[model samples]
Target: MSLLRLDGVEKTVRIPDAEPLTILRGIELDVAAGERVSVVGRSGSGKSTLLNILGLLDAPTGGSFAFDGVPVERLRGRARDRTRGASVGFVFQQFNLLSGRTALENVMTPLLYASGRAFWRRRALAAEMLDRVGLGHRLDSRPEVLSGGEQQRVAIARALVRGPRLILADEPTGALDVDTGATVIDLLEEVAAENGAALVVITHDPAVAARSASRYRLDAGRLRPDEPGVAESDEVAA
Candidate 1:
């Protein structure tokens, strides 16, 4: 079985005074272990919406979601939370690390929620994660003190500490320059490959998506395969 599966997913949202609008419609996809998939689309193309649903951050109005062979479309409360924490790690476009927390501390946050290990006892593990992400020397550096790429690396380290089977990254390289973004991408590819984990990156840049094994585009709430510069797959194949 694939590490993660989405079968006919759908999501609808209601604006304050407007009628309910469909953000996602019939999104069916799968991500296998060690596979790197990138989703690219314009701002309103439902890329973020689909990622949120896949990460279990938001519920789908229709269709089913299964993670690691566990049926989670209808799961609620502890069951859903448990599945999310145990199977998925999410990295947002913005480095969501606390400004006051050091790199090691940020990496430790997931472990605190996951391993149930004491805060002090998990320091070594956090440090190891930082090292793995190429931030060994910056272990004690706070987010504010670190560069944009460093902060993103810290966010990545935290995501990795959970040892999650799947990662949902939303514009992970959005905030950095080309050189820094390339380094960050390399880091993500390295660790995830070593761990045999699946990674899904949401982005708008074809250059970024082209680096992935598979790329999909969301356009007007429709999902289609992406082929490099061409937004549509047919253009590249023919």
Candidate 2:
């Protein structure tokens, strides 16, 4: 089933006393449950803006966007926050972990906004997630003490702790060495698949995008199918 749907989406930012600057135009994309997709784009190609929109961190200025069959535009304020927190997980290349927090504590961060018993059982859940990412032994390790690969693994554990329906990874391997990055990506895909979550990796690297079953290119604020067998007509419409 389709977990995410975006059509004719646009994002524009307004500066003081100036005309709005358009960052994304006519963006169309769809992701199905348990599917793996990738969008490749160069720096300054608006991929980050697209990522924010896809993650529900920012709303589109035009067109329709839906998650789990509900219109995102219809959600307001905290409703949006709850929906995003429950359904979307994010991984960044920089491994945005808290400086002083241990691996386990960092993984438990998401439960801070959680409701019901999930919040109460946060410690066990976090430990389980950390173990899933092979960091159980490092539960007390701080971000500063971990290697690049280890830190990213901790970040992954934190992102997946809530079992988000969609995993949005933005250049997740950017800061690691080639072999380490590949290993981490492999682990990410395996864990995401095991959790039955759709994975969307946004990167400028062709090799990274090639791992996905569906490949698209983002250029000039538009997305087009990038794989050879995928026809131009199959491009995501806007």
Candidate 3:
């Protein structure tokens, strides 16, 4: 089943006395559960805007979006927040770990907003996730004391703690050395796959984009299949 669907999605903002600036236009995509997809684009190519929409952080100005077949337009306010929190996980280029929090604490933080059993078993679950990412021994280390790769692993553990079905990684390897970045991506893919989560990697690096099962190039707010001679998947909008 598809975990996400986007058809003719667009994002536009109005300017003073100027025509509305469109950051994204006619975007179309679908990511099946447990599938890995990559979107590669230049710096100003609306990647972040698209990621925001995908992660439920913002709404598109037009077009259709659905998560597990439920239209995004129908999910309002707290309902939207709950869905985002419960079903989607995000890994960022900056790691985004809290400074004073220990590794275990950082991973446990997401559960603070969770309900029922998740909040009650937060520590155990967080520790399990960190262990899954190979950080079992660094549970008490703060972000300041960990290596770049370790910090990213902590971020991944935090993202996975809620057992989200979709993992959105935005330039996830941007901050590390090539070797460290590769290791981090490997861990990210491994853990997401193990958990049956669909992974969407948004990056500028060709190598990074090539890691996914399906690939697309996003240029000038438009999307096209990256594989040469491969017919564009119907998942792309007409």
Q: Rate the local accuracy (lDDT) of all candidates.
A: 0.82, 0.87, 0.89
What does the lDDT read for residue 184 in candidate 3? 81
* Pairs with backbone N, CA or C atoms under 3 Å apart (clashes), candidate 1: none
Between the candidate structures 1 and 3, which one is better when assessed by lDDT?
Answer: 3
**Clashing pairs in model 3?**
none
Model 2 TM-score relative to the real fold: 0.92
Give per-residue CA lDDT, model 1, range 68-108, as digits (tens): 77777568898888778777888877989987888888888
Full candidate order by lDDT, most accurate first: 3, 2, 1
Give the poorly placed runs of model 1, Cα more than 4 Å off. Answer: 116-121, 228-238
Assess candidate 2 and give its lDDT.
Answer: 0.87
Worst 10 residues of 3 by lDDT: 229-238
What is the alpha-carbon RMSD of candidate 2 to the true structure?
3.6
TM-scores for every predicted model: 0.91, 0.92, 0.92
lDDT (Cα, 0-100) at 154 in candidate 1: 90
Candidate 3 lDDT over residue span 1-238, tens digit each? 6799999999898889988888889989999999999998777778899999999999999899999999999999999999999999999999999999999999999899999999999999999988888899999999999998899989989998998999999999998899988988898788788889999999988898888989998777888888654432223221
Going through the candidates in the order shown, the clash numbers are 0, 0, 0
